[model samples]
Target: MLSTRRLRPSKNKPKLPDGVRIYAMTDIHGCAHLLKQMLRVIDADLARSRPRYAIEVYMGDYVDRGPDSRSTLDILIDRSRRGNTIFLKGNHEVFLGNVLRDPSLLTDWLRVGGLYTLMSYGLAPSPTPGDEERQHLVQAFARAMPRQHLEFLRKLRLTFTCGDFFFVHAGVRPGVPLAEQQETDLLWIREEFLKSRQNFGKYIVHGHTPVRSPELLENRANIDTGAYATGNLTLMTMQGSSMLAV
Candidate 1:
């Protein structure tokens, strides 16, 4: 694990274009209903403001620990088709892809909320799946997953930047230059990123570590709000330096 203490501020920072309003959401887990409600709120807020342009950035963790992973992905896929949106990859997604490729990893996946994800696809969740059973589950998932959802997961971005804000699935590694941070850290870092107050050049907005409420820090903002467990999904509205949860 990387050290979190005595971190320094970043030098390379990028800003979002002028007059652009962005709605950044993170860590839906498998709460499709919450996601739908949040989107409606965002749409209404955007319409009231009427910015020159708007973009929706989803910071990933679309599945696991919740009842509707399949429906959540379906909603996100449909939303992507309607307008501008950016989908990011979370640790859960990485695990999902890995299990799809190597069934042996299913045991580890199941321990960390993958069972719910499997159930969402209408597949049986087993502690010890035989070779034949593993193959059947894989095939079932393949058949259940829509083409667009597969593409969405396959092409999910690791990081996104807009007007002085950097977005990632998880927090960035402290002390490492933003451009040089590793994918492993970006997707899975916890204490190091959470404990450090070092300026990451841009305000990093991320989700992975769930919190009871949104955490606003000098370097980053954690908006996960544990939607899968808490039923409170956070949707943040950002315009220049002004930001608020709707």
Candidate 2:
């Protein structure tokens, strides 16, 4: 069955260009099943709405945690090839790349669920890998990772802007201008961005810090529903000045 929840209209509703629709998603955390389910719902919604143009903005964290990280990337890569899609980099993805480049970071990466991702690529990661083991694991991962997947990860964007919304994996820095925002803050910031009431130039649509449900604040919207653990993956659809969570 189709699932959707209309957002309560805010006084100053953000608008999209006429006839364009955006389906924003975030924080899959390697849950391929949930991602597939959400994609089906988006497809159904698109069939019914048939807007002039549509864009799917993925807020990243597509790997790590849960299971099936490989399949998750497979699905997303395929989707991107099919049509209009924007992929943003998330902190977890940063960890993946960092560990690949510098094996010394494996211990830190494993703590935040990088093991699952390694396992999904058919490499069994030791819970506490030593320096030598870390190097071996990284080598194995490089061999196991598909060329396309590596390319996709390397090419991910930090932000995507469309009309009145700025899409990112995590919240932007509170005081930084959108163009001047740093990559670290864009992919990792939380407290300051969430706590501040400062108006970002555009309506911020992001995910990284998962919420019990989708939050549609006057300034921003968070669509991360902790899909890996809670089995709730959020897809926020935006068109004109209306937003709906599915």
Candidate 3:
């Protein structure tokens, strides 16, 4: 069953370009099955209400935690190549990149669900890998990863702005300019950005912290419903000044 809701209009409405519609999702966290379902749902929506222009924005964490990180990336990469799509970097993606360069980080990364990702790519990860084992695992991962997947990871954007909305993996710094936001804050910050009631110039759309349902606020919206564990993947729609979760 599909659940849909129209966001309550804020005092100062943020609108998209006329005749344009956006389908945005966040924090996939390796749930390929859920992602596939959401894509089908989006397709059905497009067929029902055709828009002049449609853009899909994925606020990342495409890998880690769940059963099929490799398949998740494959689907996303294919979708991006075939259509208008924007992929933002999430903290987990940063961790994955860092582990490739500094194998020592694998210990920490594994603690936060990196093992599932390794398994997805056909690598068996040791729970407590020493320096030599870590290095070996890194080499194995590099060999197993597809060239296109590496390219997709390397080319991921930290943020995307369209009309009156700013899309990112995590929330942005409250006072910092969007252009000046540090990668750390864009991919990881939580409390500071979430607690701020100040207007952020343009409305923000992000996902990092999970919630039971989409949190539609006056200044930002969080659409990560913890799909990796709960299976409640969220898809948000934006058109003109209207926002909907479908």
RMSD of each: 5.9, 1.1, 1.0
Instruction: Tell me the RMSD of model 1 versus the true structure.
Output: 5.9
Candidate 2 versus the native: TM-score?
0.97
- TM-score for every candidate vs. truth? 0.90, 0.97, 0.97
Return the lDDT, model 1, position 181. 91
Query: Which of the two, 2 or 3, has more lDDT?
Result: 3
By lDDT, the best candidate is 3
Error of 3 at 116 (Å): 0.3
* Model 3 C-alpha lDDT versus the unseen true structure: 0.92
Give the per-residue lDDT digits (tens) of candidate 3, residues 198-226.
98988999999999889988899999989
Please estimate how well model 2 matches the true structure, expressed as its whole-model Cα lDDT.
0.91
Q: Give the alpha carbon lDDT tens digit for every residue of 101-174 in model 2.
A: 99999999998999899999998876898889999999999999999999999999999999999999888898
